[model samples]
Target chain A: MSFALQLFDLVGIFVFALSGGVLAVRQRLDLFGVLVLACATAVTGGIVRDVLIGAIPPASLADWRYLATAMFAGVVTFFRHGSIERMRNPVLMFDAAGLALYAVLGTGKALAFGLSPFAATLLGIITGIGGGIARDLLVARTPVVLQQTELYAVAALAGGGIVAIAHALGWPQAPAMAVGALLCFGLRFGAIRRGWRLPVARGTDSDS
Target chain B: MSFALQLFDLVGIFVFALSGGVLAVRQRLDLFGVLVLACATAVTGGIVRDVLIGAIPPASLADWRYLATAMFAGVVTFFRHGSIERMRNPVLMFDAAGLALYAVLGTGKALAFGLSPFAATLLGIITGIGGGIARDLLVARTPVVLQQTELYAVAALAGGGIVAIAHALGWPQAPAMAVGALLCFGLRFGAIRRGWRLPVARGTDSDS
Candidate 1:
């Protein structure tokens, strides 16, 4: 079980790191900036969750595997950015897959740590989106999560809520997590394919 | 000692929150956004420090006083922004005060947590600047800390380093902390007054 969890975490980290590295490349940041963003995006959310839950030193810092995965992703993205840019759809799919896994795993971890269901759900969404937010911030841009029309945060909330509910209902862990991940991935994929967007606020009278 | 620490924390939170609120008003964010940015700016640094050191739930979340301070600052800023804007120098002074206090407090806490001197110093700087970075990010701006001309991070590092060094030298905790704070405040205050700036990186041939 631990090995499987580790594998899942590594894959998620790799994909997230790649996204960060690609962004850094686009921004024309130095090599150091690219690696820093990759590592931060890959692990910062988990680190934030661990800290909030009182997990000291965070698994990302304590365990070298996570760092290694981020570095590997950054290197690959740096060298093959041209080809990777051409494969935008595949990259987006990978990002969605990572988001789904992170949401489920984050909720599960928060639940294990005795967080309230509401808090756990929030943490799960944070885990899914926190790294991306951090990445965008470093590059001086608004986070995509905050933008209207993206189903990112909404999908994370849904997936996290499902995990929390399943745990509350005494559902088996593995299958429950799987279902949560699938739901998150499906929603995100559909949003991308259909260009779905949430409604924006109409201009208030004060604006005019 | 605990009471004094709490008082210091509250003051810092108030000042930071005020800065955030003022920024929000300038950005034309609604009331909710103002409050969110205020609270985020005031508490994020300490939260980041607590998490890094394995302090659970974060003092900001655990203590209602911190939240109240943030809200109070936000409300005041929202209603009296014109006057607050006129008091720009005072606000900058308050921000410097907050930065000094946070740097000293953060280093002290990290040292208490048994972190190495280098790590503790870094944490102190993070505690000083983290909230501001968070504030800028939420508003979709480049962090002032990363700006080439800003001496903000440099001042933080110096103050934090003093605290760590004093601790390493077996100085009395209270006096050592006081000295660290004073140094940070003086440096920051001087920088603002004199328009001191760090050197920017020279443009490379690749740029041309």
Candidate 2:
């Protein structure tokens, strides 16, 4: 990976780890639980993607930097949660940045792994949302991605789809990735600002 | 994998799928949710172990049999849930069978992957409990494995540890696996029968 890509990924991991740690505190998880959630949320997406694409020992496990970054985020959140919680907008901004970057990065990685465009796109979405899903699961909550309360998965899919299309068209990787990330960020940021939600499934009982 | 191992794994997957489907039904999830949970619970453990051990495309993904078995179990539960729910003993029996089989099977697979005995043992325990954890998470409940209500992880660890030790000692695979399975089954069954529980962590707030 290029230095730019590595830096982007590290930033994403740190932000995601912070989000996970914050959630852990809200859930009243112990210190161990906080760290576990933080690390799981920060790296599980990439791990799942890498595993599916036949990359063994996942980057998260092979490289100590990722683990250290996650742990650092966890410890920081543990002590400074009160102050952090008050800066909700900045936190949400960081989360959006991470989400956007992960969507494109995951798609790019899957392509590099020689997956079909469709499969690569799917993997990219998984890489974007997988961490949050794992974190919510650990805390015993329905995953936010599955909920009809936001455009999270839609944004991810959009980013991943863009990357896949670009790859298929033999477009330059750097520009393609940048455009995809921007699109994802724009959609997610708009949804957060406007409180947008996807239409939920109607009640089966009422239909019956 | 030998025919015997294949058969054992199929049985475990079927049983675990049934448990997942049943849980989804109880949670009032739709048919899609039921199938999703069934597949997730049946395959996640093996997938995790394979990924960690550098076995890509996971056995669960590479082999169609695993998917077929899980889907069949889910469909059966969807149709026969009323009758199935009435037979509590059978459900518990199946779960125990799965738990026992997965523990040893996972350990053996890890050893085959050339992982260290300790890592293999950990993977085995993960394989035993990972499915149920995914099932509970999907339904928005705390994982039963992590709770203090039973000797679940302990039983798995015992079985896995036994297999690791036997392998390290150059014991024949068949006898070693049989012994591990029996030990796991016995411990899990005994815990269920006697209502045995691990001690809960005392509340910290009171101490503070």
Candidate 3:
């Protein structure tokens, strides 16, 4: 395994766990419930992605690293939730970066499995946003992805497409990953700053 | 499908949708959000179960009835939120029944597809519990299945095991399905009524 890739995965899981932990505290969930939500948000995406890619006994179950990282993050958040909540914006930015990293990684993995680009991109988005979706669904609400303001999905798409482009051009792995991450962060931050969004059709099916 | 089975399927879908809709309204979500949640809970499991079982395009995507039933239930719930909330117990009972019916149907489908008994039972549980899990996860809560609960998993197991046993005995479809459904409801309702619970290990492994 690439050390850099593994580092990115660890960071992604940690950040997502932090996000889930913050939300759990916000919702006033008990300790076990907090851990449960944190784990769900931190690991569900990669597990689903791996399963869909036909990686049996998903990475979440096979490798101890992801679970350990998520659990550690959850525990850390449990003790430092107040401080973490006060730094919400910065934490969200970190989460966005993690989302980008995961999106690129997921798409790359899907492509490696010989899926079509369309399917790969879809998997990338799913891998990127699925954790948050699962997190939201557990709490009984519409996912952040479907909301008008959240640029979460856009960031994933941009990062995934960039990875695909670099792959087409035969870029080295390091350069491709770096560019993909940059594109993802750039698009995500830009969307947040500029209020960019996909238009929801209001009155007509044709608009969609 | 047997007419009785088809009828129960429709009822189950509607009840599931109602539960979703009520929860959405309680959360102060918009109409579209309510509809999405309702539809997702009502059909996403069967859709996923079908796709995983290699039923191309999936039943949810193919059948308009499922969508219509869910959407209508959502609409009705939106307009009658107060009344529906007042009848929460009855609604829950319906939801439980839906769980039984869905589990049996899903198990039967898995068995027909030649999956092993273990796998079929798992698929049945997934099919039965999956929608609620998805719904809860979207709302950012830990799913009930993963939490300390009385016999939800066991209920799905019973239903699936019944189907497997009946298949092993060369029983016809209808009787097998009935047996499975009854087993599920019996286990689930019994647990609920008796407050039966499985013991959780104490914090011997804080690391776990």
iRMS, all models: 5.4, 5.8, 8.5
TM-score of chain A of each: 0.95, 0.95, 0.90
* Residues A97-198, model 2: lDDT tens digits: 999999999888888987766667767887989999899888778777755556787888889889999899998988888999999999999989988655
For each prediction in turn, the share of the native Cα contacts (below 8 Å between chains A and B) that it retains comes to: 0.26, 0.28, 0.16
lDDT of 3 by residue, B48-153 (tens): 6775566767787798999999999999888999999999878878887999999988888877877655556656877887787767666666666645554676
Tens-place lDDT per residue, model 1, A130-177, is 899889888877676655556787788789989999888888888888
Ranking by TM-score: 2, 1, 3
Which candidate, 2 or 3, would have the higher DockQ against the true structure?
Answer: 2
Candidate closer to the true structure by DockQ (higher is better), 1 or 3:
1
Q: Which stretches of candidate 2 lie over 4 Å from their true place?
A: A1-47, A54-125, A131-140, A146-208, B75-80, B194-208
lDDT of 3 at B49: 71
DockQ of each: 0.17, 0.16, 0.11
**TM-score-better candidate, 2 vs 3:** 2
User: Which candidate wins on lDDT?
Assistant: 2
Query: lDDT value for candidate 1?
Result: 0.85
* DockQ of candidate 1 (2 decimals): 0.17
The TM-score leader among the candidates is: 2
After superposition, the stretches of candidate 3 with alpha carbons farther than 4 Å from their true spots are: A1-47, A50-208, B168-172, B204-208
Span of 10 residues, lowest total lDDT, candidate 3 chain B: B199-208
User: For residues B139-185, could you state the per-residue lDDT of candidate 2 as single tens digits?
Assistant: 68888888877789899998898999999999888888899899999
Give me the overall lDDT of model 3: 0.78
